[model samples]
Target: MPLPYFGLRARISLAVMLATLLATVSMAFAAYRLQADETRNRFELAARTSFESDLKQALYQIQYGPVTDPATALTAYMTREQGISWALLDFTSGGRPPDLWEGGYRVDAVVRRDDTPPVTLPEELVDYARRSYPEPVGKLDVDGYLVYFGAATDSLVLVEFYNMGGLNAELAKLRWSLAAIALVVSTAGVATALFAAKRIQRPVHAVATAARLLGEGELSTRVPVRGRDELADLAVSFNAMAGQVGHSISELQAKDRQQRRFIDDVAHDLRTPIAAMVAVVDSLDTADAEVRSRSARLLTAQTRRLARLVEDLLEMSRFDAGVADFRTEPVDLAALVTDALELSAPSADVELRVHGDVTLTGDPRRLHTVARNLLINAIGHGAEPITVTIDGSRPESVTLRVADSGPGIPDELLPLLFDRFVRGDRARQATEGSGLGLAIADQNARLHGAKIVAANDGGAVFTVTVPRGVTTTG
Candidate 1:
């Protein structure tokens, strides 16, 4: 199964702290083991050396001196070693130790250099030593924690006991010290883990908080980037996302405002045509023939203007709703531009420049609308020299540019030139039609997998880039 889940900081702190604890404990355990073993080895070495030396001396005395002088070697040993207590067993009668210590022939008196109270060795222990005759056997006495080792020959056996309680107490202190050291180090590890986690978590927490604020309508929220790492990259990405979102929202809001203003303007424009048509209808009963004929013409003009406005409104709705479609077909680019010039601005002082046999696949009607709108905009807002260029030079795409030599588009309005109802030079846009022609043209360009870019090069320049080369079935 997967490990349990927790917060990032907690998980980080816990993992680091656990690793630290494990490493510290492993070191401490190894150190304690080595020290404890060394302490035990030191005590054991002392016992082994003293016992081997005294036993060797007693053996020498038995081999060289009179046999009755065996006690001399042991007494001399008791006088030499400070902490060692010696016991001698005589197996000449080939039996266990004597039950009595007072003048017993088989078991000699226990000899010690110190005046401490004596402990009689257990009978079972003595019997075990008798069975393990030659080899030295160690036993720990519980009362004084005396460590005993016995050695034997054919007749005489030497047993020695040394109290290890003081040494053992020192070892206990050492063990506690090690445990305390381990604990202190583990606590330090926890602190270090927390410190590290805080450094890492701070950036993440900032991003989280910023995201929350952004969601709550604080579009200006951004994260601070600190380092060239993954976390910093996340912060940078988040800040970029926030910026994009803010830009998109600002655009949406501007579009909404424009849409609202367009609606209001359309409503105001509707009354003029409708009132004129109603007046024409009201004058039908008048008998003056010239007045009736002029009223009839007024009615017809108002009716046509209203119909055109309604059609423009419907087209705008289609574009906004994303239902306007572009059906691709083989199109003659230069011929379409020439037709648009004649239909939209035939009488204007405009030049039509067709470059090569410009044939491409595109939506003819939409492409024509793009040309028609650019021509209309130029004639309405531009001056003497109007030029439309149909450039099919690039193998991958068809380019159309409609430029006019007039007082150029205002710098403030250039960015939003194609936004619906965004009319600059109020006198120029005072036509009786819906102000959605340029916006529709822009949308149609995008629908055809292209874009309309507007700039001011001496005057207003509108360039329509229609992507081609990639063949389409329909």
Candidate 2:
């Protein structure tokens, strides 16, 4: 039969209980069989010892001893063995079956015990002896009673029946006792199985409940570890997984907040330039030549500043969209840096040095943008003397470092230095620059399979190492 619905604990407990019950019952059954067989053997042996010798003596007197009647001698033996219900048979017609009697064979009875009723020999027992056994067999289990037959002479066979109601009652009581013990042992086993199942499933259930809670947005839910076992290892692994999930989600949330701030900063910066351009346009209505030229120049500068912010935003969007393709080709890294310096800060006090192979295969446009942005960031935020070094000393990489003797980055902003819209001096005018310079530089360096990091060693030092496999070049 199929069992009812059950959880893991119930299933485990039920399985163990069934196994225990089966084993206990099987062992009890085996013990009962062995004990019952031994007791029956001893019963038959005692029956033989008590009656076989005397039965032989009665037959000898009837056949060859004193001139005594066969019935009288046999009757005397039956009366002597009291308390044992027995029967004697006299096979007539020379012990042959053809004229023995109807119903296979029939024997003349000699039950001479007058104190009790006469015992009738079983018809099936008589027939069995007529066919297979010419003489009485030692013992015969006839109809659950212990019966014995012995042939004292060719024509005279002695039969005995054991009154086993008392002994049968005792054996019945023993069977019940063994069954009771089996039931007790099986019940105990079931109880122990239930306890063990609970012990194992408790922690597993805790982990499952905690996982459900975690999925429902209780990110801090955790299970307590118990002993040193596989379950404890499961708890440790689950806690580790929960920790990593929490960390990744926290990072994503922070990045989301930063993106919102970037949009706000973009809107605020755009407003300023637009407002300045509108004022400059109103000023352009003046009649004086110098003032009109000055307004025109002011308008152009604000427009260019707005254009650069828009361009940086578009570039960052491309990176976020995973579509910024780098068209790589052979380029002189040192010359690119020099060109960027002359373009972005021609008159700024800066030191430049190139060492080892300064040639690499990369997109010249993006490289130029990276070099230009770093130099601009240094000039705008850091104090002189700014030092730019391109060191291709490593076999498979070239390092570019830009160091400026400026106040180092604030401790609060170091971890998020490469994030978008983060400025060195927040109070600086948006007209001075957009804060996407370093962020864009970092994106470009990473896109080119390069590593760029900013740190402070006596000043703000920005280092970028781009892989080139360069050994030597001019």
Candidate 3:
């Protein structure tokens, strides 16, 4: 199977279990080899010590007691030992074997056959013993038996053969015991690894579940933090990010609803003027001269109102799309204000005042539009005695303030003054001019890195501040 198909817990458990099993098997195998070598060395040393002791006793009996034949004494000693068999060769008597000993003794039924006599030690072993006779004791293998050789006297050598089936059986038992122990240790290790994996996987599983819920638009979903670790920190961060995303989505949805309402209002405003022009179109052709002139004038006024509304809508769209173009130049603020006032030509009772002369870098045409809109709005809603003030005393910036003598703006309307299509009151809403005048002025000021703020000290005051050495053209 692919490794990814496994869960985190299973993968971690498998990794830990494999590591434990590998270490256990390595140590077990190493211990088994060490134990086998030690067991073999111990068995060999015990056998050699027994053979040397038996030979020394036989030599003492020959020197101090009434023992005439050393070969007979060693033969009697070998027959008395149950698991040991021996052979005595007399090299002093021209290589003749001793009496009462028939060839070699067989230690097992497999080596001793009824169909034939037991096989004796070959001549190779006898010659080896004679050639290396001066050595006191040594070990060799004759047929299937393990033999230990000891030189009892100058002319006599005693060779003892031991049964190896018992040593082999003991070693086999040790191997089986070690294998069983390793199996038990490996099983216990896997269980421990699984328990550890579960502890680690709990937090991870919670995070995955929360993430899945978030993808399905459940932004409030969060994982619980239990400890001061990286996983707990991850849970905290995820919850914080989810909250931010939910708030942003809520704000965007509110803006979308406001935009839809604005589009509906634009459609309603255009319908009124177009309907009025359509109703007066045929009246101009059917009436007398005087009546026809009135009809033509009325139609011309509605047509101009519709055209202005459409132009304002188009300009708002350009500003919203960040595509409004500009041409930068130095323009005199005092001259621009005077030209706007002459163009508007308000009633004679309204007073006009020019305070200071200031020259700044900006788009002249757009700045003129700003001044004209502020003047027209003040004249329409504000009282007479309008005062226009310019202050360029600051080295880095300039300000233009237009204040009128009237009741100040409503407290609720002040906050939303620059919003598109927002009028001060119901009476002002019915006046001539689209409601986008203040909004257009606000956008134009922003394009030049400026700000327009509305407040009331004596009456309504609109202040436009433009930064020095700035251009709107990009």
> Which ten-residue region of model 1 has the weakest summed lDDT?
99-108
Error of 2 at 180 (Å): 2.0
What is candidate 1's TM-score against the reference? 0.77
For each candidate, the alpha-carbon lDDT, in order, equals 0.77, 0.78, 0.76
Clashes of 2: 0
For every model shown, what is its TM-score relative to the native structure? 0.77, 0.80, 0.67
Q: Which stretches of candidate 1 lie over 4 Å from their true place?
A: 1-26, 68-82, 94-109, 113-146, 179-218, 227-238, 285-292, 341-351, 382-387, 403-413, 424-430, 453-461, 470-474
Clashing pairs in 1: none
Tens digits of per-residue lDDT, candidate 3, 1-474, equal 765588888889999899989988998899889998898888888877877777777677666656577666655655566545665556566555443224443222222212222234444454565576445465665544567765666667676666666777888998899889988999998999999899788888888888888889887787888788887898788788778877887778877876887898798788888888888887878849987888899999999999989999999999878899888889887888778888874452444454444888888888888988888888787877888888888877778898888787889998888988888665356587678999999999988888789999898999998876776632
Winner of 2 and 3 under lDDT: 2
lDDT of 2 by residue, 107-175 (tens): 234343333233344556655554543345656555445667765555556776665555678789889
> Which residue runs of candidate 3 sit more than 4 Å off their true CA positions?
1-9, 19-93, 96-205, 215-217, 226-228, 326-366, 427-430, 469-474
